[model samples]
Target: MDNAKLQQHAIAAECFVEVPFFDLDPMHIVWHGNYVKYFEQARCELLRKIQYDYPQMKASGYYWPIVDMRLKYIKPAKFGDKLLCVATFKEFENRLKIDYVIQSASSGEKLCKGYTVQVAVTTTDFEMQLVSPPILGQQLHQFIQAQ
Candidate 1:
């Protein structure tokens, strides 16, 4: 989705990260794989804001695992460059779908944009759930009501 469409979701979170030297590749820019880490950081912030992070998910007898992920890199993030990562809920009833954007902290230039899709799975039986569990609905409801 486009940026305007991404803004339509009320459930979202943002976090800032400074690219670490260790994440640099031989070319001296961030490795392609590191973007996923940045996305996860922002995603965790979103889940925490909704009070349904990993611990809560497990406690609710469900495990939400990423089944799909896609990323588009527009620019290279160098070491020490600060980036703003945003994560927003795209769809959450049937599965957890989140959209992400990574931009330069100072310039606001988008460095990368991506999305992740996760589906609920039963922790006890290890069965993939066709629909999200009730706890997710409850948490999402609470988030929307609070906003």
Candidate 2:
């Protein structure tokens, strides 16, 4: 991955999530699909940190929708496991891309890694935007520069 660019424009946030009993599968580990929910939780926190969360995105007349996502699960998380989910901003000029890491909060062991790509679209016309709107790029620029 582009670690240099990531460090240059890094925006990240972390959240704790305890694996719930309901999330476990019949085999006693968390279901694969549940990882996406955990990623969303962390992503929401990351967006809020940049002050461009879903509400703000809609209010700005653009809708940001995830167009791509990928996940690599390395370890299984069992019920009651304390997991730390981290979301990091990766790109913002053309589209929004965020990388995610979910790991054991106690051991710092990585359990999964993933990235999500979202593109901006006009809310009124539902037109896909080839490039992200200025609002997003501007906010990310100011946030990164301030950091």
Clashes of each: 0, 0
* Cα shift from native, residue 134, model 2 (Å): 0.4
Error of 1 at 98 (Å): 0.4
Model 1 deviation from the true structure expressed as Cα RMSD, one decimal place: 3.4
Give per-residue lDDT, candidate 1, residue 18. Answer: 99
Local distance difference test values of all predictions, in order: 0.90, 0.91
Give the alpha carbon lDDT tens digit for every residue of 1-147 in model 2.
233565676679999999999999999999999999999999999999879999999999999989999999999999999999999988877888899999999999999999999999999999999977888867776677678
Q: Score candidate 1 by lDDT.
A: 0.90
How many collisions between residues are there in candidate 2? 0
Error of 2 at 88 (Å): 0.5
Quote the positional error of residue 112 for candidate 1 in Å.
0.5
Local error of candidate 2 at residue 96 (angstroms): 0.5
User: What ranges in model 2 sit over 4 Å off?
Assistant: 1-7
Q: Candidate 1: where are CA atoms >4 Å away?
A: 1-9
10 residues in a row with least lDDT, candidate 1: 1-10
